[model samples]
Target chain A: MKTLTVDLGDRSYPIHIGSGLLGQSALWTPHIRGRQVMIVTNETVAPLYLAKVREALTAYQVDEVILPDGEQYKNLDTLNLIFDALLSRTHNRTTTLVALGGGVVGDMCGFAAACYQRGVDFIQVPTTLLSQVDSSVGGKTGVNHALGKNMIGAFYQPNVVLIDTDTLQTLPDRELSAGMAEVIKYGLIADAGFYQWVSDNISGLMRGEADLLATAIERSCACKADVVGQDETETGIRAILNFGHTFGHAIEAHQGYGVWLHGEAVGTGMLMAADYGYRTGKITRAELNGLRVMLEQAGLPIVAPADMGCEDFLSRMRIDKKVMDGRIRLVLLEKIGEAFVTTDIDTNALNQTLCAGAQLGY
Target chain B: MKTLTVDLGDRSYPIHIGSGLLGQSALWTPHIRGRQVMIVTNETVAPLYLAKVREALTAYQVDEVILPDGEQYKNLDTLNLIFDALLSRTHNRTTTLVALGGGVVGDMCGFAAACYQRGVDFIQVPTTLLSQVDSSVGGKTGVNHALGKNMIGAFYQPNVVLIDTDTLQTLPDRELSAGMAEVIKYGLIADAGFYQWVSDNISGLMRGEADLLATAIERSCACKADVVGQDETETGIRAILNFGHTFGHAIEAHQGYGVWLHGEAVGTGMLMAADYGYRTGKITRAELNGLRVMLEQAGLPIVAPADMGCEDFLSRMRIDKKVMDGRIRLVLLEKIGEAFVTTDIDTNALNQTLCAGAQLGY
Candidate 1:
């Protein structure tokens, strides 16, 4: 078992990673501040882990709200379902909300907690690799609006994130590959050694080796926690954590949410950022190809949607949260292990990258 | 102009009060950190003051979203209009949202700013006296849900609260009186001297005497600012700020929102709290009568809805944000000038107060 604490001062919480931690009441008992608990999960996840969570919280009054699964349902209207459940059940300020699914459930439940009666205690029980390594650690929680992905949300932290690795054993291979996109992101953004480690053990991770997968989750969470602790609200250096998100959000919004898994879009988006980096002389072509190789090996997409044009990417990217005034600010890689945010993108290079088809990493 | 700062550490901002300050760009220019501003107003207010505000913001790229006026529209559906407008216009994180109407506009816009791209800069230009004295000064922002009022919202503060007393001149008689309910409340909960003053000059304030009204607005904001500064999230002393809100929210929710203006409902709620206080021997009958006289003179409701049974009040009050562990917590007057929150309630006394009807003060 490995535990990483996201040190957000008073708002800080721990990310507990291990096997069979879900049914262990001791692991999450202290974090449940109130006598009442509401477990927010999705249809797909409910049938799998809901009962385990309910049985664990047998001491307290428990309620459950099951939402439809998928990123497309991550919007205000769907988010309201959680609100309806809370209000109808008369959940008070002291009542704690437990998010019991992947990123979509975690985001919506965390946000619901943030707004329910002007804020309440929230806990995250992430059941997906993408969620455990990424969404669960950072306090960024929200729903996606039609105009853009994650356009409506809040930076609300959870009391604790319970990551039961046993759940991943049930995750589909495609989903595991999707989760690896973010694991690979941790390396490409800040850690060269971790990147090299992932490169060396990519196949082991893909094969569902418990030890290797656990280590990757720990390292990813630690990196995310470190970044979030420094810039809880993403004012300065924290923006670096969004290395491929700008480009990825463009892909997600243009392709329609749920079409490409968030990790898949980010996977392709990172390649796009690296491509531009290589063209701008920020990173060597060899480093760019290395990232592309890792993404492809992880069973992730290495190319943007064929239907999307330069204008689609450009227009969608402009609506990104990183955009200031009318200028688009993007997170670009200086090399395989370092990334930086810049507003100085050359249109010609960007256009070529957008126009690049299968020739991207060549 | 009188300036009072809501000292919330780095999140602190000022409340500016005076007549004709809306045209003075100098007051709000420093607070706007962005190049773009979106003024959110309602149909009732736009035709009257939108042009003046737009003319003042000529130097900046400004956009306006006009919503239907009234408290019934203060729900998640109307809030989506602001989100839709912001996204369609491609408003970025740096964009400042200016709430240009009353409490409804300020609450929705402030909440919109809080959730738009996980928070943005917000400024309040409160036009109604109800907004100027109460909503604008508090960082409380949210929309109503079907089951409850303010069931979905955030404690997001604005950069500045621009209160133009001049706008009150155009306010209807009932609306001006509704605003007085909150003004009277500040006096009832925190300032005996202010209560006495309101008693002495109630008619003049109702008649729209500029100096008296301005002083009343400043004093009310100062009281609210002090309470907010002490407890930003209402964990402790701040809940006292919702003196009549628990009872008030029940009225708003049961009667259908916008039926009784928020302050009017609060007016009756305060009297109910006082009635309970009197029945519990917490205050003298004379003090309760004094509060009733002031509310009556101010043209505010002195009784709860006759159609509402004690069960209705109890059921609705349990859903209040103040409730904890199925126990209803309420803010009650220890005396005319002091208020405290307690979950300790005698069912017999509470039922008596709820069933008092027009005989409340007696």
Candidate 2:
């Protein structure tokens, strides 16, 4: 297993990437502090992998809360279930929470852990390729509010993130493709060479080549770790890590949550941002085409939905967490593998790009 | 106005105490970071004080979300209303939340502020005596879950707490008595002299004697500040502040939220602890009697409900946040002014004390 550290100092944690890390009990058992453990998973992941996790946790008293799998379940109501099970079982601050699914489970469990007894130790056992590469590495824990995504959460780090690449064998092709969006995002925002590596190894990753997958996950985690270590709160440089999320979140919010996978929305949002960047002369047409080609190759959408108007999209985008003081600040790529946030774009140009993207049938 | 600093170093905030401080815009305007502000109050408090607060914010753009009054309303449903208003109007991180009611409003608004855009600065304009002395001063923010009281929350402090004693005139006698329970508790757990002061000046306080009320509030805040500063996360010393809370929270949880006022349940819980302390030889009969007399004079309950069974009460109490590693740690009094948390107590002694108190018809 290759390990990458999210260097957040006291809040920093290690992300383990390998084919059989989940079977390596040594990686997680040391972090389990209490006898009682609550493993939070979702319906999609519970039946498939919860038993292996439970078997691994046999030395400790384990309780599992299986939630309906989707972004729709990521709210206060669902968060209550984890709390109910913990309190009903008399779990205390010492009780450790194990997040055993994709980003949804990780975010919910991480947030529940954050609020449970003020805070508790949580280990991430990500089941999806997307989560293993990205979400599981960052300590950004929270649920989405009706008005915005990730509006209610904290920057709470986990003790360890157990990323078993083997679990990706069970992920749907669409889900695998969805996660790649984030994998590509890491390279797009910070590592141009890594972006090219993803382009080079897309097919090998699609074939579930373990070595290639391990390299991608490690590089993505390293990029995230470097950014988070510098700006843990997303105040400045870390905000760049959200390259396409401003538009992505709006797409998810506009389409209604769960309709499209988060990474799918983000994938399309990244394309929209590239077009916006190109229109504003931040990137050349060649760079925009390269981004589109790479995203298309990864099987991600590159257009806004035809039914959604640009004005409505703008309205939804305005409420994104990154939009400070009511201004729509978007993370736009200056070129492939380079991005920056700006609110200075001309409105006519933005609308023109939105209009063009919508015509392509998002 | 008498201003006391919470002494949290960099995070320390001033607690302004006096009559009519809410009307002084100069005291609040300087704290407003930007042009937009959201004032959160209840129906009961809004009709009475919202206009005055809005006037204070006349220099800036202000929005108001008037929630329903009572502890029952301190839930996610009500908190979402604040988010709805903020999102609908595109309120940003710079938007400050002003809690304009009692504990319920302060907690709900504070929790809302904590979750809004990850967190925002919130100012407490505590109208009720309970909040002025307790809830508003500390940063404990959360909403009640159906299964438990304060079962969900975060320790997010406010930027400032403005206590206006002038608003107390409109408070009902029952609410005033409820608030006094907390006032008296400060003396019971930490300040022997303050306890004696409350015993001596109960009548004056009940009769709206401003000087006595001011002294009591300041003393309570000082004690809370000291405890919180020493242990902000409730690891050790802070547990003493919950002297009556383990049983009190259970009573509140058992009877259903809003069925009994928080202070009323705490009042009864205090009596049970005093009895337990005396029986266990931690406190003397005279000290126990002193607590009873003060509670009686303050018109607070000094015993548990006759309808509650010892077993049921024990079950509820065991689920309290104080329970660590499956053991229930209780804060018991050693004297009128001193309290200590113990997990070494005999279970049978606690049952006998609880059963004895139930049979007393208090």
lDDT of 2 by residue, B10-91 (tens): 8889988898887788999768896789999988998899898888779877999989888988887888898888878778
TM-score of chain B of each: 0.98, 0.97
DockQ (C-alpha) of model 1?
Answer: 0.88
- C-alpha RMSD values across all candidates: 1.1, 1.9
lDDT of 1 by residue, A10-128 (tens): 88888889999999999878998889899999999999999999888899989999999999999999999999999888888888999999999999999999999888889999999
Cα-based TM-score, every candidate: 0.99, 0.97
Query: Interface RMSD for each candidate model?
Result: 0.9, 1.5
Q: Model 2, which residues run further than 4 Å from truth?
A: A358-362, B358-362
Which residue pairs in model 1 clash with each other? none
Model 1 chain A: lowest-lDDT 10 consecutive positions = A353-362
Model-by-model DockQ, in order:
0.88, 0.59
Poorest lDDT segment (10 consecutive residues) of candidate 2 chain A: A353-362
